[model samples]
Target chain A: MPEDSKRPDEKNLPRFRPATDILERADGFYLYLDLPGVSRENLVLDVKDAELMVSGRTDYRFEPEERLLESEFGNVEYVCSFTLSDIVDAESVTANLRNGVLEIFIPKTSKTIPRRIQVEYQGE
Target chain B: MVIDFGGFGRPYRLINELWKPSFLSQQSLAYPPLNLSENASAIYVRAEIPGVGPDDLDLVLTEKNLIVKGERRVEKGRYFRQERPAGGFQRMVALSAPVDADNVRALLRDGLLTVVLPKAQPKSPRKILVQHG
Candidate 1:
């Protein structure tokens, strides 16, 4: 009977820190994730409580019909994940995948948004 | 940016070119590079082809080998920083075990291309008849 086994040092959880650009604006934050070999079908985007998790995989296995001379990183499977903070908007989160890049727009929470509050004058 | 992996005097040399830089290409996307794994059944491979479309890619399997050719074209009307490799890229890999080509599947999402190659069936076992010779 075959069984699933891994080295004790191997971590079962997926770990991904996509290349991101946090442009802090007066309104929101933009996060860009580099996810290649992942399709809309295989990708999972979820926000539980205050945590955000994105996971996907890339499979590149073909039959043995041709001759290969040199191979690069193109044959490995890909899996990655990330965590979100309270400042990130969960309900309004939007993600798009095009040309192998995953771009996510995360607006800031209402409390985190910068606002100009007028201070009342109380001169004693 | 095109990075030629070079070839051994072959007609078509293997190369890697990206017309636009993907989020993964950026220093920020800290995903692990491409990797490989194997089991008694078959071998598996995953490649990160960020910013590359399916039409621009070509996968060729010939004579006990595999070849992946594709181009990463930059989106038109961009000029801030053009560091992405534009044009064409190719990766050649050696096949360690037999594969089921007809049943292979490829899926692309999040700028990544996943190829599934199944292992070939093992040879059938045979019974020996060692009678008094």
Candidate 2:
């Protein structure tokens, strides 16, 4: 957003915490992060110490010869982390990046799913 | 200045993260952040909008302004926690130097939209020296 560049210098650009969506279903939990202008080569996805970390650098600067007319955004990093729950299968986790959107699938070990128990009749 | 906690920060270092300025007063933050730059030949306008294809975007070029209108198509159904912005959005960027609208070129890749607008050559009359003969 234009909120990125309040100051003129690129050094003042704040690290943008990308907007994300977390969804839970029967199979697993899903995370969708919006990281624009960040290519796959510049993206980093790490799962360590029971934490899920997603970060990327946006190389938005133009050539040195180009003069900036209006600077709303600049070279800023996008970072966000989440503590993985016990049910999350960190080893089996998979991620995909497409059209600047990062999707992470955190499959559960059949734990997050609710199961119905049938009661037996013991009438005498 | 941005303070980086390295790649992955401490797990407990997320109390103030969820309550971002985006969730509060969204009006202050413009949608689809744009960066405008210019060289001798053309002016470049770059916008970051994920999940939006070229067909979804519409551009209207004027001598002094460029109106960008687009829709970010999103997956249907319901999401337990929805944060990423969806739906239609538009922005108008003012241009200082007149641009050749006919030659403007727009390209979309990896969700980043870059528009190159060639500057129109100045048509002002050239100064002539009038020497007495």
Candidate 3:
């Protein structure tokens, strides 16, 4: 059948690495991951043993009778992990997924936050 | 702070190498990955484009080709690792059958852009009946 012929190679489908952007600021770090086709329901983010693990499953599937003319975006699992540093306040880390893009905010620890010191002048 | 790919080690590398052929072929075709499918009466096209809004997309359909153009804007930040490509991209896909451009419908959801193009009516084969003498 033409539909069967167009079926994706599911057996060989590779776990894709989502493109990520990590930015550092004075207060914290911002992580942006491009995860197209992955909805919030399928996404999973966790921190274990000082590692930030991000994984999700995309829900792009074809019908049994549908004929695929071009096959570029295949259904696959997304997996990527990053090691967290001591400077990051793990307790305050927050993440939000919008439009299939996952944004993670890792605030810096108290020691990392810059502090201003007041000076007292002594009269001679 | 440095970010590294943990658990993506030797085994993952081996699997990636095995999958490189297909992946390379797709990358050679267009910027954003696309999927095109067709049924008896309609053709559907989907492109993967995360972080892009509806306002940033421009779609045009002709008799033989469907053109998609869009831009992905990058937020301002100090980068440590920037892998997602940002900028303008355009792609024109040739249709296998004639489509009604005016009836086409497009939807953008969850970072996937899907365009449904209704197919024009095809000429049906006529049957001939044998006459008994």
Provide DockQ values for all models, in the order shown: 0.14, 0.37, 0.48
CAPRI class of candidate 1: incorrect
- For A34-119, candidate 1 gives per-residue lDDT tens digits of 55655677677776765566665543334444322222333222333345566667789888887667666666677764456899
Candidate 3 residue-wise lDDT, B15-127, digit = tens: 45345465456443576777889988789998988888888999988779999999999878788878788999988888999988779999887788899898988779899
Superposition error at A4 for model 1 (Å): 17
> Quick one: best TM-score, which candidate?
3
Q: List the residue pairs that clash in candidate 3.
A: none
Interface RMSD over true interface Cα atoms for each candidate: 13.2, 7.6, 2.5
> For residues B39-133, what per-residue lDDT tens digits would candidate 1 score against the true structure?
56565555667876678778898757777788765444313223334567777667777898887777665665656677889779999999997
What TM-score does candidate 1 reach? 0.45
